[model samples]
Target: MSASLREEMELIEKHEEILGERAELLEQMESRREQLKLQRKQQVKEGEAARRRNATLLQDLQKIEDCLRGRQLPPPTILALETKYWASVEESIPAWEHFLQGKGPHPTDGPGQPSRRAKQQLKTHKETTKKTTNDQGLPPRPKPRTAR
Candidate 1:
């Protein structure tokens, strides 16, 4: 009976040690669970931020699309404006060409009429210079000989 009692005491001690190990394991498992929860919460927050950023970007895109839609120009009005612009350009071509040819009013003409010389200069500017040799009628001056 005494031997059986000793065996029972040793069994109780072993069970207590196993219970202590189980408690430690439970603590580790709880700590791991808490850590995972925190990580999940952080990921959720980041996901929410990303989702909000995407929503804002989508809204900005929609606004740009709206502005573009509002600013859409019809083809006919653009064509008409282009035609008027070309007509004005056609009216301006001669003046631009004349200005380039130096025959238009000088940039320094000031508030008064152009000078007569300025007008002559415009005419002379268009002509080529002529080179001429004239023979004086019947007189060739004798060359003065060098003294010996």
Candidate 2:
């Protein structure tokens, strides 16, 4: 072949090599893109599973809260119990004070324990309360509790 013809052929061969390299690069890029797409799909699936798990946990928590609420006492019931406890403390105070004194319940009464002496005082107080109420022609007071 002539010199010019040889140079032209060499140039064409080089061009074809570059085009093949470019095609290979494009194929590699397409493969990588498919792999990335698969990774993204997996991630999306995992996210959906997590979301479902969270929803289930939230439902369980809500059920637990509902059960706790059901078990809780109403405000009125709590208040009533507190009132009764304090009332018993108030009722026992006078007997406690009398016992603390050296004189005890009275000169005639023995040095009785605070509880027994308090019961005696309460009986007298109740009878006197009934007599006064009857004398005044009013309804009697509510019966008081002596103990907790």
Tally clashing residue pairs in candidate 2.
0
lDDT string, candidate 2, 1-85, tens digits: 6999999999999999999999999999999999999999999999999999999999999999999988967699888999999
Candidate 2 weakest lDDT stretch, 10 residues:
103-112
What is the Cα-based lDDT of residue 3 in candidate 2? 95
In model 2, where do residues sit more than 4 Å from their true spots? 73-148
| Candidate 2 clashes between residue pairs 3 or more apart in a chain or in different chains | none
Report the Cα RMSD per candidate: 19.5, 23.0
lDDT of 1 by residue, 29-118 (tens): 999999999999999999999999999999999999999999957799898999999999998788678867978764445557775567
